[model samples]
Target: MPTPIKLSSRNDYESFLEKFDTFLLDCDGVLWHGNTLLPGVREVLALLRQKGKRLIFVTNNSAKSRASYSLKFKKLNIEVNENEIFCSAYIAAYYLKNILKFPKEKKIYVIGESGITEELDLEGIRSCGSSEDDDGKDFDFNDIHPDPTVGAVLCGLDTRINYKKIAKAFNYLYSNPDCLFLLTNDDSTIPYNGTLYPGTGSLVAPLIKSLNRNPDAVMGKPNKPMMDCITNEFQLDVERTCMIGDRLNTDIQFGINGKLKTLLVLTGISKEHDILIKNAPIVPDYYLPSLGDFSELCK
Candidate 1:
């Protein structure tokens, strides 16, 4: 197994950052936690843009669509466009259509939030049930039939998930071993109002755990789909692009998988002591106190 390359000093990190003209950033943890921006994040972004760096905000949170995320960023005073943002919903839709070889018109039962539905519509993938008639009605579990022609189970963040939906997914997955199970991300919970709230990962994880079914694929960070999307959309070489984020499991793993330089900032989930713990698969190429430290490097 390959070990993580560690940069113990600031100079080592600067050397790595100097080579990259394009940056793939994780939004929630790296730039800000919740609604607040990390110190010096704006300045660093501004400086990068001023220096003509190509920056792409890549996120696995499929609860919101790209357009929604773009609007949020603009409200947060970050100058971002829709093209610069790529979410797991978009990636999942693409993977189902092109990678898993699911037909574009294949009808799928999506037990997910609006973002997932929007992405499917964008890709021209048809949903199995409901129109304006079932707008506010709960998802009907009976609608999922155990037909061999049933393409796949596309799981996203469903806030209204219940035992019936989980049972349907489990039954379908059990019956059709070849049927694809595409998950957006595995984040258990998201921080909300100084407390933790169930995220999409939390909702889907139980179904996977109960049925003992690993996903056919996931289309988020640390997975190849998001990385492929970044490369195709940004036209960036993996060697020259850097991924900076605050999570070990997602952001750092994405860099490790993609073979890009990774920077772990302390403003988010993973902390300093977590790095010292040996046998962690998700390790950063460089560690900083925060994004503020990155600003100092730019100076």
Candidate 2:
């Protein structure tokens, strides 16, 4: 087996960053906490740009589309184009179209937020609800029947989900085990304005719990699909790409799994002492107090 790679000092991390050409960044915690941008984050981004390093924002949140994120980035004073942002929504669409090889016009049953439906549309996949009748009008429950052509069951963040929808999705999944069970991302909760709101993972977890079925696939950070998409879309060299984030589980694990350098900034979710815990599976290639510290390291 190959020896595990580790970095224990700031010097070691700076040396690694000096050689890297591409930077894969995590958005939520690393760049901003909810709507609040972390201190000195802008400077770090500017410095990276000045040094001619390619930067790509990789996020696991699929509740919103790329266009939504692009607008959010602009509001946050981050200059990111559409191509620079990659979310789980994009990966989910890619997997459904390419990996599963679903037919161009196949109908899908989606139990997700609006973003999930939008992503399916982008791939030219048709989504039908259980209530649709022959004429495409909403049908009563007595007349509702599972559409045999349903290609897959896609679960995302559905704030308006009810028992009826959940039951329908569960029945479809149980009857069609061969059909794909795709999740946008596995985020348990999202931090917003200092409060925790249920994320897609919370919504999907119940279905998994009720059916006792693991997802056939989850296309997000710490997964191979997102990493592959980054490489293919940006033409970045994996060995030279560094992942910088504020979380240990997702961000650090993504770098470790992808064999790229990982930097953990303490300005967000995970703290410095957390890594010192006895059984922590996550350890970053570098540890900084915040993105501000990274600015100094580059100089």
Candidate 3:
């Protein structure tokens, strides 16, 4: 358990910036709060780009696809390439298509948003449910009809998650032992616009409790599978990379577990005192009041 150094001054930023050739940034807390961009974020990002740092916007939010995330960058007036974004939805699709070698004849039953289907489509894989099941239909045991073609049940952050989707997903995994159960991210809560809301883990809690099983794979932060996907695709030198985020458990732990440097920001869930809690499970290598502190380096 290493103590985290606070980064504040310009020299601190300069020294910190020199250590990492690549930066993996978490979206929700460090960069923005919902649709609003944080202070000095755009400037610091520009500076990082100017210095030729490889910036990859890694997010556990699976409600949006890569394309959708790119659009969000555009909306924020942030100049980011679509290739620079890696959302859990994209990771899930990559894992299914490349790692699992998901069969062509089989389709995935999605318990998320359109992002899951969008990414799956990009991989030439078929997915059912999601928006199709967003009619708020009530779940009925008599309506249960498992589709043999459905080989997996993929769950993510679904704002429209209902009993119908959970019941249907439950039946698929329950009836077919071969049906793979996957979660884009088991995040219990998400930070948005200065508040926390139920995340993917909350939505998937019902199925997990009912079936007495966890996902075969959780494709997000603090998980090795997602880290493996990024490393294999980018061919990054872990020593020259750093993961920056607001949370201790997911973002910082992801970096630590992946053997990369970790930086904690205070714009989101975990405050500075969290690292001092008794028996804290994870601690970041460095801490900053806000990533905006790096803006002085650009000046």
Candidate 4:
């Protein structure tokens, strides 16, 4: 087992600066909590950009479109482009259209926001069952009419998750053996606006239990689809690329799964001591109090 290396001293930080050329970062916890930007995150990003580092923002949140996410960055006075941002929604769409070769005529039953539908639309993919109609309705469990046109069922964070959606998704997966069932990200919990809430996993749990079938794919951190998307798009040297995130299971494990070095930050979900405990789920290569601590190297 590889123990985490704490970069405490100036020499340690400087040595790390020479080591990595690219960075993969998580957006919610590692960069900011909800909409508020963490202290020195801007500086750290600016410094890394100035130092010619390739920075990629990888997030599992399937709520916001890349354009909207970029607007949030612009609102915070951070320089960003749509290309640098990678979200689960985009990858889910990509995986379905490209990897799975899902037919264009077939529609997806989506239990998510427009962030997902927008990406699917970009690929000429159609979707139905958004919160507008599918969510919050009562399910009688008897005359459940599953949409035969729905060739796939995709789940993400639906704030209004209810019986109707579950019944439909469950029936689609249970009845249609050829129907693809996927999740943008199965994060059991998520941090948003400085609070924890049940994530996509929780919303999809009922359907999973009722259908008794696992999703064909989970397009998020700690998974191969996300790694495949990035590695295929960019030429990243596995040893030189580092993934920095706040969560242990999703983010740190994501790096480990990709065979890239990892860095855990304490500013979000995981505590400093969480990684030090024996038999940790996934230990990072290096850690600091926060990503902003890397600003020290800018000097």
Candidate 5:
């Protein structure tokens, strides 16, 4: 039962800052809640920049593309480069394009929002079944004429998920064993504006149940695919990098599994009690009340 050191004092902040040359930060809970900026986040980020620390925003939110996320940063008046963000949507696209080398003649059936499709477009990959397919039309077994050209089914956080989309996606996988199944992420719940809502994992439950199969790859936090992509892209030295987030399952576990330093912040899905529980399955190397704690150092 190893206890996590609480980062509170200025000395603690100094030591922590000096320990890592790169910081991988989770967006929703650690930096902001929905559109609202968390307390002292800007100051802390500025301080890190001043110290010449490399910052990377890593998020499992597949509902937005990197360009869309960049807009959110601008809305908050935060100066962030598009390259500094690595999102699940982008990872999925990258996987299809570079790793998977998806056939040019084939198309992807997207069970998600524009985020997934937008990234796919950037990769010069064709896709369908996103916002355009989310019409209020009821599902009809007869309407499902499975497209053999649909080489893959990519699932993400689809707020507009309906029976039609699910039925179509299921049919694609069922009819074509070769049709690859991919998930942008599997976060069960997402923190938004201080409330927990069903995430991408929840959306894919029906598909998983009906298909009786897991995705071939889940390109998000705590997954090796996403981590490998990041490592290759940045050439990161895992030992000198720290992962900071508010969730134990995805964020902290991502860091721990990758052999990187993990820092848990008590501002999102995971609370202090989670780590304090007896025989906790996962724990971070350090815990802090918030990323904003560095505000004092910034002062």
Candidate 6:
């Protein structure tokens, strides 16, 4: 019912910050591109902290765990705690362990990175398929087999993804129809070091197509589980929280799904015109060229 507001005026910008005490931010594009921090964005974060606002980093990236994310924050000279960071890998493990009560005896067949493995370990769940599984040899039909003990197949981005990995996942899902199919996120691509690389979704597409089975849960932006992890822990009020990110499909949709206010930043996947299109799937409560723009208000 309400219209989207672009915060270009001084009064609008200040008012936007004042309206919410909690800020949920996306990592890759809104805060930094790859390892490089966006200009003036750090100052904006410091300003938010000075205002005593709650800051949570929500990312679809399942490549790293909380500790890894914290290490990155430390590297960037950004102040963020492990508890304040929420990633799809962490949430997937949490959901399976806490909510689903996944059996301890069974193992999760992981088609992901170290992040998923680490998170599952913290949750006391065993898993198979790590870098060690990449033997680099072509998978033979006679040699391929799925572990009967695999209760779930967890998918995420694998930089070294190859046909062998897909074959293993496909066999696992095909053989064990009851096994839960979970995805860390459906982010089609990730921009890094000035190049767009195929993301987790792209890596998992082959399996999805061959198996003809959709993931039972996608644990990332726009998905309820990721937000639930933070909301349940912090007791945050959706009415007073703001979800900020560059992509409308995930970040903005996550806000809308949770009934929280949304802020769209133009530094990442989506642009100004994307949100203005006719019959747009999602529209944020506010928009800005980048979070860096708010650095002016920090002064």
Q: lDDT values of the candidates?
A: 0.76, 0.76, 0.91, 0.87, 0.92, 0.89
Tell me the spans in candidate 2 whose CA falls farther than 4 Å from its real position. Answer: 1-16, 129-144, 296-299
Deviation from truth (RMSD, Å), model 3: 1.2
What digit string (tens of lDDT, one per residue) describes model 3 on residues 1-299? 76778888888889999999999999999999888899999999999999999999889999899999999999889999988888999999999999999999999999998888999999999999998888865666787798899999999988888778888999999999999999999999987767788888888989989999988999999897788888887978889999999999899999999899999999999998898777678889889999888988777
Better of 2 and 6 by TM-score: 6
Estimate, for each residue in 173-278, the C-alpha lDDT of model 6 and write its tens digit: 8998898889999989888876788988888889889998789999998888897788778988888999999989899999999899999999998988887877
lDDT of 4: 0.87
| Residue 5 of model 3, lDDT score | 85
C-alpha displacement of 269 in model 3, angstroms? 0.7
Structural similarity to truth (TM-score) of each candidate = 0.84, 0.86, 0.97, 0.95, 0.98, 0.97
Question: Stretches of candidate 5 above 4 Å error?
Answer: none
**lDDT of candidate 2 at residue 249, scale 0 to 100:** 74
- Residue pairs in clash, model 2: none
Q: Compared to the true structure, candidate 5 yields what TM-score?
A: 0.98
For each candidate in turn, give its C-alpha RMSD to the true structure in angstroms: 3.5, 4.2, 1.2, 1.6, 1.0, 1.3
Instruction: Enumerate residue pairs that collide in model 6.
Output: none
Better of 1 and 5 by lDDT: 5
lDDT of 1 by residue, 44-156 (tens): 88878887888998898887788788888888898987888889988887777777667754567677777777887887887642122235556676665675655787777
**Angstrom error at residue 266, model 6:** 0.6
Q: Give every collision pair in model 3.
A: none
* Model 1: residues with Cα > 4 Å off, grouped in runs: 1-16, 128-149, 175-178, 278-280, 296-299
Which candidate wins on lDDT?
A: 5
Scanning candidate 6 in windows of ten residues, the lowest lDDT window is 130-139
> In candidate 5, which residue pairs get closer than 3 Å at backbone N, Cα or C atoms, i.e. clash?
none
The number of residue pairs in model 4 that clash at the backbone is: 0
Alpha carbon deviation, residue 183, candidate 4 (Å): 0.3
TM-score of 6: 0.97
